[model samples]
Target: MTASVLRSFWIGGFEGADHVNGAGEPLDMAAATAHLELLNGDYLRAREHGLLTVRESIGWRLSEPAPHRHELARAVQVATAARRHGLQVVWTFMHYGTPPDVSLFDDGLVERFASFAAAAARALAPLHDEPPVYNLINEIGYVAWAASHTNLIHPYVGDPQGLGEHTEASGYDVKRRLVRAVLAGMDAVRAVDPRARFLHVEPLVHVVAPHERPDLADLAERIAGYQWQVWDLIAGRLEPQLGGHTGALDLVGVNHYHSGQWEAGTERRLRWHEGDPRRRPFGALLQAAWERYRRPLIVAETSHIGVGRARWLDEVASEVANARAAGIPVEGLCLYPLVDRHDWGDPAHWHHSGLWDVDHDTPLPRHRRLVPDYAAVLTQWQARLPGAPPLPIAPPVPEPLPESRANGVVPCTT
Candidate 1:
């Protein structure tokens, strides 16, 4: 028997402007509108190709710039455009960036966030009745890692001296506080849209190596705790020592990038490596999530850095199919960055990870043009199901003609 495919789309940045830069800045309204136009065009393109659901974000930082004042005109425009294109949106309320003035550790922050989430739901409820699925935060585990260990983001700078300075304590505290804030936010939304559902997104960690020190192992366990802890909290199974609360997750969203593998030691040998097709970790992550949470799961973000996206998507789609055959309720998968985006903070350099490559300088061709890796997935999936319905085709968008006429894509041998 053939499995049914669930189509979906992801729109907007996690936090309005923060997603574009490590430094939190308010997104320019005009520029943001133009970006939305690009996103809408991508949706129209994808729709022509056969996708139905698009997940977009409602950033806390952008929604409520101040305690009571709400700013949602931009988000509304995006959401409305998405609905017009006949797409279902899964609204992610928080994706890593909170209001600049709010500290994750503050109780006030939690209350304020809850209020903001409630406000957002109220504003958006009229557009659709099936209250949007609210992802409380994106990758809480990664957020904690950024603030506590890697110092890639705010509040921490990876200071060696500060390493011993409340790193673990502060990290855990911030995580717990954020979860509470999410719960509060959900409660507020329920007041407006009782049918609303919650989505908890986190990175799945594959510990490749454990450090020699038992303490390091314990720390790793604690970090892993962040993933399961919210589930436990919501299911009313959290230990008192963890300062747990009830009702933190309703759905599970896993963001599995190729770079999620980790190695532990004092030197911190964490590196993101593409896995062999025969041993993909994304499957393990989904299986683990099913065993642990038993909730609906979605691949929130799964792509590779540079130009290997096609193979990455094929492997991920196959894994999803396998998991579904095994009775896992794998609801949907979203291809992130719908189009290639400029580097987070540095707009000059392109990430080159989109299905279609973008050159700011010139026009590009639409058909007979495929990224090698993406083309591989397209061929494999087609071969796997020769009679499958073709994805709805969007009118050909312009693309630069390929310098070479190669039509075949190389499968990854590594």
Candidate 2:
């Protein structure tokens, strides 16, 4: 069967994670960057670019601050806004943040997560008549890997020393836990809304063994497979005990960056630029995921750190074109953090990876000024997209919500 593509050819990504930064401090992009306070303006800005879809966070940390009891004021507002703006919402349930009272290693972790996921879906049901789209448990694999492999943040649970340095086993124990959490969350969403769709957002990568360690070529391939373990588990291809079925898995969203390529079993980072024989093209990496899952694929997250913003976007556009040529049904390319953000390790240092950059020293809703140079480049690149959908003369206005939903007792229907 042919893979599916999104209704809109491209989408925008809003940073909404409410997690702590590497320096052991909290980082709620929506709040820190005034996104929450100025959401209406943010939506207007994004819509102005002709984006009919956008990614947002449900703020698990905000809701369920305590066990059982839940607060969903913020989530309700976001869902309503998306409907008002007529934007297809792909909400992120867990953006690397859980309640302070909960533990990822707790015996009831899965059940606790399920309750929250179901609750979020129910709250939005009245707002969204179509099947809900979700990036359930956003980038869980990266969360576990970063915490365990580096001082980026404290490890989630067991193995404070990290499994990466251990020589005894596969070192994928962290990845396994992430997959389990995802399966549980997916089940929860389905229970509440059977028509729910998922986008398993994970980093796509490539690696090779060093010349001196030619014997490690096989080992390198195994390490590369680590990236596919979660998907494989969900598809029930690799681990049958995970309770995953073929139909449970949905679209695949890969977060790719210039530095995603690297040398396995070492600290070497591979270049992801043009004409580098060593550098693998983004299309090749995307094809690997598409071929394995046989599902629609999207470049869910992509951006450059500095002045290379324009060039980087141009390269990604080429990758999207190539993906289309390969019959991969590549749906969209999202520029994450459409607004520039602070560094995770050093909040003082800003990364100029966005089309718009705000002055941190300024006050809340710090006027998202456009980066003229990058904006011009983006315009040119967007126009050059091979299969880009033409912009509608007027944005669609969502249907007026029925009065029955005001009672808050509408039963969800397929």
Candidate 3:
């Protein structure tokens, strides 16, 4: 399928992760960034800037606080807002967070999440003119790695010392569970609304041995291989018993970030600039994914923080342009966290990673200001890309959020 299915080649992603952090604190990024309180303005800003397609989420923890008990009225409200703003949405059912009673390791998580997925589809199916697109689970591979190999996610919080061979094995086991969850969730949604579409999003990465440690080349290849495991599993190429099939691998989304490539053992990121021969072009990675999956692809998520935002986009846009020109059929590029967000574990620190920056000093309902340079770069790419939305003659100037506006997002149940 082509990008013609989407409203535009540019997509804005709202920061909707509700994952529990390393500190054991549950995070609601959409609420923290004031996106929930300022939904209309946020969606309007994206549409005004020529982005008609967006990625959104309905928190699983909040939507289903207890087993088989779902509260999706608020989620439906959010979907209504998107429809009102004339934007097409790709809703993320889960973003690395599960209910308080549910553990990632539980054999029952797949069924629990599948039930929630069906409930969500039932609530949202009527809002869209076309079949609503759903990203069943965001970054399954990364979530598994974080939970097992690192302490950033649950089941491993405050357990950084366990990052050795045992943890590495655990990571794969967790990945298998996540893949099963995705497959079951896809089936559940289809049962509720057969026309519902799905997007499987995962990190796109490259890895290499440290220059001094040439003997570690094989190890580096194994580490890089983790990136493909999620896709392979969903395609039934790796494990068919999970109920995966070619249909489970729908619109493939590859999220690229500056830290995506690195030296294996030391974890030192390969420089995206300064002539690192080991660094691969983003277009090459996209091509490799297409050739392997033979599925239509999109850059599901990509952005940089502070000073690098525009430059990163320039590189990504160039790579995407080349990929499309070469007949890759890469559909769209989404600038994630359309508005800036704070670090999950350290809410005091803002990433300054979005087209709009949030003011931390302000009280509840913080103000968001546009980054002119980033907008200019985005506009330039919009003009260059075929079938892109028309460039706005002038950048949008966001007004300060009113103090009377209260945070409408459901409180975290965890």
Q: Candidate 2 lDDT, tens digit per residue, 1-414? A: 112334355677887777665556766777777878777888888788766778888777777878877788888898788778777788898888778766554435666777788888888777776777788888866776654555455334335564443211332555555566666666666667766778888899777887677887787777777788777876768665555556656778899887777666674766654444667788889888878887777778988877788788888888888777767767777888788877765767777778788877765547788777767766776676646432222211222223432222222221
lDDT of 2 at 310: 79
User: Any runs in candidate 3 off by more than 4 Å, and if so which?
Assistant: 1-3, 155-170, 273-275, 387-414
Against the hidden reference, what TM-scores do the models get?
Answer: 0.76, 0.86, 0.90
Question: Who is ahead in TM-score, 1 or 3?
Answer: 3
Among all candidates shown, the one with the greatest lDDT: 3
Judge candidate 3 against the unseen true structure and give its global Cα lDDT, from 0 to 1: 0.81
Stretches of candidate 2 off by over 4 Å are 1-7, 155-171, 273-276, 363-365, 384-414
Tens digits of lDDT, candidate 1, 1-414: 112222332222221334313354433322432445465676676565445666677776666677678888867887788778886677877766667777655667766776788788888887774446777676665565566654455554544465432224325556666665665566677777876767677766554334456557666555455566655654447543322333344567777776555543433435434233323356778999888865667677666656567767777788777776677766666666555555544556666665555556533212212366674574465444223332332211222212220111111112
Report the alpha-carbon TM-score of model 3 versus the true structure.
Answer: 0.90
Candidate 1: C-alpha RMSD after superposition: 13.1
lDDT score at residue 27, model 2, on the 0-100 scale: 65
lDDT of 2: 0.71
